[model samples]
Target: MKRSLGTQLRHLIELLDGAVGAAYEEAGLTYRPRYTPVMRALMQNEPATIGHIATAAGITQPAATQTIALMVKQGLVTTEAGVPDGRQKLIRLSPQGRELLPKLQQCWQATAAAAASLEAECALSSTIEAAIEALAARPYGERIRAARAVMVDSGKS
Candidate 1:
């Protein structure tokens, strides 16, 4: 039986994530792949609530909370009470996390360059942005929504 395109796409996503993680490790960084998305979201918008980060990162609230706890333990982020919602906390990168931001940015750039180089060297034929646009133009938002639904169904959210 032939494998479905969804299966192949899933595998490719995993491969890309692993490759990015390896690139960061090669750069002598501890490289927590799970934390990268969280950090990226935070870097894009500081002082965001944990719930906001969870929604933006497409992760469950519990997962986001766990990630934030780990980051706090690692001194990568700090949290304080929110003004509007006293019960909710605002998360921001710690001084150490801020210091590492530039390094992380560099690692991402290196990873992108490495992938581009491999695609060129192997003559792999695929336009990534075009593929993304095509995915985005799907009738029901995108395949990402389907994936997220699976995650939700699995009690992840």
Candidate 2:
């Protein structure tokens, strides 16, 4: 009856995202946490391909593509043909998106401050960072397989 680690992590992320989304709505900003990576990628390097954005945002290509489609629909970004390869499309912030940057940055700062306050109390940020680094060094799947092998050898199922 207990939830898995993945499920618990997802629930925590959803709760945090909901709180941040509510704050954005209250501030009259239409921003969402999901859009942050895309915005940041474009802000840092405009006319970037979806692959480039994905790498810069630390997300998968499919996720970056989906986010780009949504951003395009929202008029927050525009796409143009890549210069070197006309078949490739490059993404950039729209004029509207550019205009919203200042407010977005302010909201980002406030959100960061709120997260910092929570981090100070709970050390959640550092803990999560350490966990990520540990996992990167040795993935959970590797650990799980090794444990399973040991369990089977001991007839523990």
Candidate 3:
């Protein structure tokens, strides 16, 4: 019996996420699934405000704040007062975070290479990215609010 379209898509997502996670783990990196998206955003745009980071990463403000706190405690990020707005905090990679940046790049590169090596690889890459872009095009705050609503309503949070 064939799987439903939604089931197939979900399985592909899980496989892609798992493969990347396993690759990073095998490389001895201590990256969390939640942190990967945030780290990628930070790597692309350093010295951004926490609000901007949260928006870019498509997570709630509190979620971004918590992630930032964890990263700061782990010595991966540093925070300072925003230049123009003293009320807002600016975030950037710490020295240690900067040092780990190259390793992060290498890990992703390895993952990409592995994906390319797989059979039917081009279609796999296209499907994954198109799905990601579709999700990314949605309003981040709305998505988070909806997800929170569902979790709360279902009492499975």
Per-model TM-score on C-alpha atoms: 0.63, 0.90, 0.62
Candidate 2 lDDT at 86 equals: 85
Evaluate all candidate structures by whole-model CA lDDT and list the values in order. 0.84, 0.92, 0.83
Which candidate leads in TM-score? 2
User: For model 2, how does the per-residue alpha-carbon lDDT over 32-145 read when each residue is reduced to its tens digit?
Assistant: 778999999999998899999999999999999999999899899999999776888999999989988998888889989999999889999888999999999999999999
The candidate that achieves the highest lDDT relative to the unseen native structure: 2
- Per-candidate clashes come to 0, 0, 0
Say which prediction, candidate 1 or candidate 3, comes out ahead on TM-score: 1
Off by over 4 Å in 1: 55-63, 115-157
Rank the models by lDDT, top first. Answer: 2, 1, 3
Q: Which ten residues in a row have the lowest lDDT in candidate 3?
A: 119-128
| lDDT comparing candidate 2 with the true structure | 0.92
Candidate 3 clash pair list: none
Candidate closer to the true structure by lDDT (higher is better), 1 or 3: 1
Least accurate 10 contiguous residues by lDDT in model 2 = 24-33
Model 3 clash tally?
0
Candidate 3, which segments miss by more than 4 Å at Cα? Answer: 1-10, 55-63, 128-157
